[model samples]
Target: MAVSDECKIKFRELKAKRSYRFIVFKIDQQQIVVETLGGPNQSYDDFTSSLPSNECRYAVYDFEFITAENCQKSKIFFIAWSPEISKVRMKMVYASSKDSFKRELDGIQFELQATDPSEMSLDIVKGRAI
Candidate 1:
């Protein structure tokens, strides 16, 4: 699917203004890492521990993460968008697998960020910022 112009613009703006951080964890006895960018500062500050091992398929080495008290209350997912195929693929899983947490990853999303500003484009952008 083609990203909206507004989304593209917002994505660009985020690319220019946001700072990204990564977190490694495991679920179901599986190891996965999440790399998140933007959102509130607390998103990175409120994490208690790493996620458990689960099925993750986003990046090869690193993922995305944010530290927020509110976000901690749910199972977060890392999905990648493929402009060539017009679809979003779930690559990494970030969820609070603890029964006490009882939080479902709602509204959790991602976009690919380009290291080079010139490479930022729908055709080039893969996943949300991370």
Candidate 2:
């Protein structure tokens, strides 16, 4: 699907913030699905493995994350399951110094509460709560 203009704007704003990492999502039918990509280190293996058989219909890995600087990003990963979304969409928001990345990730848990996947578009942008 084509990305909305609002989502483009929000993405630009997010990039400007230069945060370490963030997850973007959208509500699909009655379930929320990750709108971003995942990789070996960032995969939602644990979460997906724990789901009931009927709930495990989607692919575990839907996106690929690529970065030029590996040393500067955070290796820390977090997992959370909300009835809000049925999948994970964790990703690095920017590439910068290690210290800056760490600082940005420190407060992300709190910020995540404000994210409403229902408001987000399919492209993971143009969300009202973004």
Candidate 3:
């Protein structure tokens, strides 16, 4: 999916603020793509602390896991969304595990796509969605 310039700008601003342990791009109303940066033992507080202060209609926390081959894999383990701050406060819909703070990406309204960590581009982090 193509990201707009506006979204890229928002991403860059958030990166500059060090606001997100992971970054997910809302491709559309029903789809979001994400890349995880945190370790396997990441905490919920640490996760929330990384969120951008700016409004994000929807977001998914990508949890990284090590596979049998020692490859890192990501899975959507948490979801958050806010229609409008004035109307409703942003909330976390799910958490993966009590100890792991992980949740499976299933039955979500928005399709969460997990991309390769290497796919995360500096341009996107700099607010230029390439």
Candidate 4:
């Protein structure tokens, strides 16, 4: 599947202007498109809750976290969420198409794939930030 031009533009807006807190993308009509965007005020819980329990999606989250040294830092995380309950065929398609999709985003700082939410839990994200 190809990444749509709107997807690229939205990513650029998120990266350059912090226009969004998170972006959820999905395969639509053979193109990867933005399904929804979290506003800057949205929390991590909000983003996580936005994900459907039985689906596959690609997301980018702006994670602003406090470091062990008591400093503030932010990282852009590219996450591929494919739950075990989702269709195997859909998982395969998402897995195979990930590289091509993320490559177009330009500034993702961390890459994570989750077959289960625990794998991409807050602790894991914090660990990556550390």
Best by TM-score: 4
Q: For residues 59-109, what per-residue lDDT tens digits would candidate 3 score against the true structure?
A: 444444466688774443334433233222222322112112212222122
Judge candidate 2 against the unseen true structure and give its global Cα lDDT, from 0 to 1. 0.30
Looking at candidate 1, what is the lDDT of residue 33?
Answer: 24
Scored by lDDT, the top model is 4
Model 4 lDDT per residue over 1-130, tens place: 7899989999899899999999999998789999999999999899899888999999999999887799988899999999999999999999999999988999999998998888889889888977
Q: Which pairs clash in the backbone of model 2?
A: 7-126, 32-85, 32-86, 37-63
Full-model lDDT for every candidate: 0.28, 0.30, 0.36, 0.92
What TM-score does candidate 2 reach? 0.22
Order the candidates by lDDT, highest first: 4, 3, 2, 1
Expressed as tens digits, the lDDT of each residue in 5-29 for candidate 1 is: 3333333333343332222222323
Candidate 1 residue 47 C-alpha distance from true site, Å: 11
TM-score (C-alpha) between model 4 and the true structure: 0.95
The candidate with the higher TM-score, 1 or 2, is: 1
**Model 2 residue 25 CA deviation in Å:** 3.6
Per-model TM-score on C-alpha atoms: 0.22, 0.22, 0.29, 0.95
Per-candidate RMSD vs. true structure? 15.5, 16.2, 14.2, 1.0
